[model samples]
Target: MMDVGRHPNIKLLAYSEIESISGYIGNFHVRVRKKARYVDETQCTACGECAKVCPVAVPDEYQLGLSLRKAIYIPFAQAVPSAYLIDMKACLGTNPIACGKCAEKCDKKCINYDMQDEIIEFDAGVVIVATGMDVYDPTELEEYGYTRYENVITSMEFERLISAGGPSDGHFIRPSDKRRPKTVGFIQCVGSRSERRGKPYCSNICCMNTVKDTLLLKDHYPDVEAKVFYIDIRAFGKGFEDLFKRSKEAGVQYIRGIPGEIIEDPVTKNLKVMVEDTTTNRISEHELDMIVLSVGVTPRADMPEVQQLLTLSKTPDGFFMEAHPKLKPVDAPTSGVFFAGCAEAPKDVKDSVTQASAAASRAMTVLSAGKIKLEAITSVINPEICRFCTICAQACPYKAIKVEPKKKSIELIEAMCKGCGTCGAECRFGAIKMRHFTDEQTYAQIDAYLEEDPYNKIIVFACNWCSYAGADTCGGARLQYPPSARLIRTMCSGRVDEDWVLYAFRKGAPIVVVSGCHFVDCHYIDANRWTQKRVEKLWDKLEKLGIRPDRLFLEWISAAEGQRFAKTMIDIERHRQRVTKEEIEYTMKVLSEQK
Candidate 1:
């Protein structure tokens, strides 16, 4: 980030946050809230004279609470702009008139306590989101004794303690006693790969990081004993396995198991970890001078806020979702925005840098092009049919539908829309229609299929990308299934309007199946989630209308699941046969009457 900030082409704005993001690719308007620094960056020389005489002292966050810093100080040694910033929240001058000594001592007179936060706006062709990640606070896991024991530290704190510029000047000493430790224990997966407390996905860096730390410890003190407890060691990266072997050769004992509890001795403040070694089939306890929790990475707590701000989607793991994980790894569902670093998933420094560079390249691709070409599959609002209810805008997940209040109509932004057809499906007034799959075209297909034996046949609405492809694969594989099933392909399951489902039942179709990509695997990224919710609501409506909810089925059929697709069709056909013609006719009558 410091390197990016140093780039001459990049206008790095420090202490700024995105307030609002509006517009589409090749033309985005962004509003940033520039926080007050309280010091003039152009005049401040960064000399320590003002800080040396400053009276107010506070805990230095850069040192991880291991050292003290003046109220007016640089955030870190290599901070950009090299300007002193006043901690207004802690500064005495901001609260009371007790301190102005720093300002009095400054020869350049750069200090100013009256500066207010400023808002700035800019136009950008593209955006790269590299929000990074936050380490899980092991203090939440009380079993680890993190906050209770001074000797128990997080992996981040351990990094700083072992850093050359860190407090104690690169010396590895226990926080409680400030003495060199003879034995050290590292607990792996403190906040990772656990359903009970932390996340389920592997943090991808903890195993190698522990190895790095162990090597660093061995280099510093050859005689010091280092033991690591892990469920499994993941050495998948380039040269990572060699580093793991080096750590093992350096006398770092690798134990395969997670520690159940960490108890501390009151006398020496030593941490005692209890674990059952899966390798030796024996339970053991180890007392160490310091215990470092190899905590995992989690999506930022404010991730939802950012998602809402940028109108982005999140994966089940809470990280920002990419448009296509393989082909478009750095691109978000929103065209203009791209993802980088741990914002997409847990990654190491190398992976983060690589992804960050990829995101930069992807953003540059858009900026280099004067304009972006959009797909014609976007939805269009029919002003003549519109009721000005604004339901389409509310239903639009991408925020692509705009309600023109004065004109009393709705407008669709083609570039912004991903062609999910959620707006068209949610509009009760028939105001919205998706391109290539209009209301007339979709209903015409239903009419044509039902013209022969609509009452005896089953109507299936399948998403084009997944369920429809699955059906095609099932046919190509020669999987035997009921011939009565007729499939209609749409861009997404979200495009399957509730009215279409009811129309099938009204036309005397014995069964109606709505299928799409599996949850978390939607091509549109979470569009199937909306399909699931819609189907659940329709189930309640079916029950109220005296129709057996069993007649209406919703299944997730992936593109690769050919056998499952054929089996599902066979199962639905068999179930449909059980429903007598009288029952089917009765349900059809009820649906028609309701319509």
Candidate 2:
């Protein structure tokens, strides 16, 4: 961090936040708001003179509030710029200029009470998101008595107490009495893998972190008893299993059960924990001098704002979703944007470093190229035929289409397009065309499928990334389904133009199904949202025409759901068999009348 701050080419803007981001991949313009520090970075030195005379003091956030710091202080020991800064919220010099003792004491005269926030702007070719994660607060679980018991602390607080710069000055002590604890209890998964109170996903590092903590405790005091209570220890990483073994050999007890309750002793300030041993089917109670909650990680509280700024997608767990989990883990779905560290998911230091390197390499590749190469398969609009209703623009998840309502014109920016074909499907006037998956080509595929047995055939339009891949997975699994369900692939479910569905229905098709990725998990951000709207519109039209709305089905299918694909196919075929010849003829007559 210090090296990056001093690097000639790198302009490290500390204490700044991005206000807005605009433009495309290679031409991104960003506006930033830099908060005032009340101390000039270039003029101020790393002397602690100002902090010594400051009257105001507050909880140090870097130490998780385990220690107190002066109002005018650096965030941490090795903070970049290595300069003293005032916290306006904690200082008395703000608004009324109540206290100027720090300014008087400062030999360099770097303090400035009149400093204001500065707005800065810059252009970049690529952007990397490395906003780290936050630890889950376990105070919500009242059963653990985390708030009531003074000795019950989180893993982070434990780190601060043990550090040389901590309030304890490198001496491990109980928060209640500042005495070295003879027995300590480490509770794993305090805020992880619990559908009731916490998230469903594993915290990825809690198990190994507990192991390290136990080893560290035993090393400091050989006679001290250390115990870890967990549902199960997942030491799957390299050398992680060995570390767990070492902790056990070093006299750390491993218990396979999460404590159900904790009660503190008023006299001794110790905690009595109750837990059921699943292995022996017996309940046990243990008393310990101190308890440590091995808290899990959570996505940053401001993740939604960051995701919106970059037009990025997020997983159901609230972490930023990668472009592709396997192929493009570091890349965001939006071009020229990449992810690193726990911003993407709950990852350990090793994995975060790996992803950071990958993201940096990807950014380097994008910036090194003088010009970007856009995909040939992008949206094209015919202005003469366009209604300029802005439906295409609204449907585009990437905001690739610009609407000029006054001129009745629509412009498609090919550079920003991912070729999801959402705009093409939403364009009711048939003015927008998806380059490769044009209406003519799609209609031909539909016509070819219905040529043999139109009334018995079940036509399916499957999205290329999800539903089509699901079919391939079904085939690989050798899952058997009725042959009547014929699939036609498109770049996205939004690519399934209503014309293609009407043409199939007019040819006496018994059923037409359109499938894509789940609403939240769309490969092209919210492309599946447009798919839902289009399908709903088609259902409304079919009902008005006196055709059965049930005949047109819209299903959400992902690549991992092979069984769902096969089951859906079988269900569609069964429904096709129940459709009578007269109903098919009626549907065909109604669809044909519309033309």
**Range of the 10 consecutive residues with the lowest summed lDDT in candidate 1:** 89-98
Candidate 1 per-residue lDDT, tens place, 1-595, comes to 5786779888988878899989889778999998998899889999978789888889999888888998889998888878899888778883557678888989999988898889999998888888888888888899888889998998888998999889878998889989989999998988889898988889999999999999999999999999999999999979999999999999999999888888888998888888899999999989888988999999998888789877788888889989887899999988889998999999998998899899998888888877788877988888888888887777677788888777885678888888989888888888787899887888888888888876668899999888999999998999987899999999999989999998888777889999998877787756677788889999999999898899999999998899999999999998888878888789878987887
Best candidate (score: lDDT): 2
RMSD (Cα, Å) for all candidates, in order, is 2.0, 1.6
Q: Cα miss at 231, model 1 (Å)?
A: 0.9
lDDT value, residue 321 of candidate 2? 93
Q: lDDT at 9 for candidate 2?
A: 95
Tell me the spans in candidate 2 whose CA falls farther than 4 Å from its real position. Answer: 94-97, 406-409
The Cα error of candidate 2 at residue 268, in Å, is 1.7
